[model samples]
Target: MRCWAIIPIKGKGEGKTRLAGVLSASERDALVDAMLAHVVQAAGQAGSIERVLLVGPSRHGLDGAIPLLGDPGTGLNTALGAALDTASGGALAAIGAEGPDRVVVIAGDLPCVTALDLDLMAQVPAGTLGIAPDRHGTGTNALSLPLPDASRFIFRFGADSRALHQREAERLGLAVETICSAGLEKDVDEPADLTDAAPVFTPAR
Candidate 1:
């Protein structure tokens, strides 16, 4: 199936505020940039992902290889909704080509996410939604949905988002398949999360 990956990134210097106690403004900015790059690379490397698109305030210092959509600035859900619309050919005709069979929505802060994790998520059967919850099993780290049904899917992405998404999927009568993987479950949000992902943030020798 043709799959498209959409990564929603907050504007530069606008994320990881929870880690302010441990990370300076510049440190947080750099962390966000690094995480975005890692996620983009993993998406690009995933064989199932045909296209990788970014939705954010500005592309700015991004790698520039992937296409970028301006964030609607309404909120996370709005940004994700716009990306889904684009993938459905309702917008961004330049990036829409026959539309994608499946759309994967991944958080930009998943530094540990690998191409294999993405490939596994893409394996969800038709008419089913694949979800990868964060370490605490409260927040959602990754989500995959069929293109036709994605437009109507509600994106509940904060505070117990895993349960919210599961309930929403059930309400929509869609099968929910949980994709559990260490890589997909780890996301950099609070200071503890950052510390846990320290190995990834470190530069190679």
Candidate 2:
């Protein structure tokens, strides 16, 4: 029952288009760093997860603690394909971590995701998939599957990703569970989105 978490991050100055107006350039970059830190911290705490993979293209001034994988110089689909291939081919095999009995793919923008959310995502029954809807309830923020290959659901990040996931799940004949956890639903995408949630990177008291 080993699991891995895949987090795809688009480096700063290129990510979070909607938040540009709400925060200064430095603020946005700092926010991205804080979000990545929170995600890494939560993934480390999730007892169910054995490893965390950061998938994204290489860029200057990018610092993350988890192992980084160079994103394939292609679109989102190709980047994901590369990650799955790594997990399926020999990387995980060599480490004795089998082809993810469970895999959790989470958005890097979600700063509020807690260890509890990771636990819940990893608790799905075998042969089923679990997804957490975004704040608008139209997009996907978190998705968990027993096996990566079983997830043929394409990500359409624009408007109705939730609907797209449901449709794909139905097509693949896989049972799906939809959850709206507070941590999973909120992400820093738009200016209003940041305003809606408190800053996640407060100094330790």
TM-score of each: 0.94, 0.86
Give the range where candidate 2 is weakest over 10 consecutive residues by summed lDDT: 196-205
User: Cα lDDT of model 2 overall?
Assistant: 0.74
Candidate with the greatest lDDT versus the true structure: 1
lDDT of each: 0.85, 0.74
**Model 1 Cα lDDT, one tens digit per residue, 1-205:** 8998999988877888998888788888888888888888899999999888988887648777778887888999888877787787777577646688899999888888899999988778999999999898889999999868766888888789999999989988899999999989989877768765665575232
lDDT of 2 by residue, 1-205 (tens): 8788988878556766676666767777677777877887788899888888888875334454456777767766577667766665546554455577777888877878898898889888887878899988888888886675454555555578788877777777789998778899998787667753465753222
What ranges in model 1 sit over 4 Å off?
203-205
- The candidate scoring highest on TM-score is 1
